[model samples]
Target: MIKAAESVGIRAEWVTCQNAGQLMKCDALFIHGTSSINHHTYRMARWAERERLAVMGDPQSIIRCTNKVYLAEILERAKIDTPATIVVPRGNAD
Candidate 1:
């Protein structure tokens, strides 16, 4: 993903959470979508926020984007722009 951005001329870096011991000397962080935005990831993301690091998509916002549930809501709400979600859900779905 960072590669995609860099391909478009956006400077990007890849760093593991284990290697991310401090943010005092850093500028920003990019936490991408993962299988589960678990405790450690969440902790690091939050710390980066408090330290004012520029986050691509904030997890604190209901963990939705990084959190699937919120993605559904956002998609549903923007169904006009994303008509695919306008389709009714299965089994008693509105």
Candidate 2:
């Protein structure tokens, strides 16, 4: 991904949790790892959004997409066909 970006004249660098502060210096963020609300990736996404940097997998998306029930509802509301699904509420899976 870095090579492709640089080939097109777009600068891209890898940022890890240890050096996430570098996000402030980037014009965009492309999270290349799993994102969870309890994870640093989510924090990074939120920070990038607050800084107004283009962010793929933005915080809101991470929140909504991470919840299977919510994602199902969205797909249903949008009339997008999906495989048959059943949502088992917490503690009700017996």
Candidate 3:
């Protein structure tokens, strides 16, 4: 993705949530991959939100996209097609 962006004359730099200072320097933010709910990336997203920065994907959207339960709710609300889904207790598969 970075290569493609750069090829199009878009200067893109790779950085992690830990590099929030550097990230803020960029014109926009792109979270290339998903992270656990407890990940620091979420905090970074929150920071970006507070700063009104141009985030490629909004923080709330990122949270929803990363969590199956939330994603299911969104899909159902939008009447989008999705395969049958069932959520069982964490420890009890039965």
Candidate 4:
């Protein structure tokens, strides 16, 4: 993503929750690897929000996209192809 941005003449850098301080100086924030709402990315996203910096995948987007059920529903509504999916109850680990 950074490479693609650089190609377009937008200098981009990857930062993490550990370097959130550095993010405050950036013009924009494009978070990656936010696998779950509980992940550190959420904290960074929230921080970005407070700072009012533009985020590539906004916090709400992160929340919905990180959950398979919500993402599948969104894809279905958009008529986007996705692998067959099922939502199992939390206790049914098997």
Per-candidate Cα RMSD to the true structure, in Å, reads 4.9, 1.3, 2.5, 2.6
lDDT, candidate 3, residue 57? Answer: 69
Residue-level lDDT of model 1, residues 1-94, one tens digit each, is 7789789987666656777775555688776545246656667777788889886545565276554556767777677355354435468575
Worst 10 residues of 1 by lDDT: 80-89
Off by over 4 Å in 4: 1-3, 90-94
If ranked by TM-score, best first, what sequence of candidates would result? 2, 3, 4, 1
lDDT of 4 by residue, 1-94 (tens): 8899999999888787667689868877887674467888887877788789997777888778777888888898899998897778899979
**Whose lDDT is higher: candidate 3's or candidate 4's?**
4
| lDDT for residue 57 in candidate 4, whole number 0-100 | 75
Which residue pairs collide, candidate 3? none
Q: Over the stretch 9-40, how does candidate 3's per-residue lDDT look in tens digits?
A: 99988878556688667777777776555777
Model 1 TM-score is: 0.56
Each candidate structure's count of clashing pairs: 2, 0, 0, 0
Task: Let me know the TM-score candidate 2 reaches against the reference structure.
Answer: 0.89
Stretches of candidate 1 exceeding 4 Å from the true structure: 1-12, 33-35, 80-94
Residues 1-94 of candidate 2 have per-residue lDDT tens digits of: 9999999999999988899999989999999888999999999999999999999989999999899999999899999999997899899999
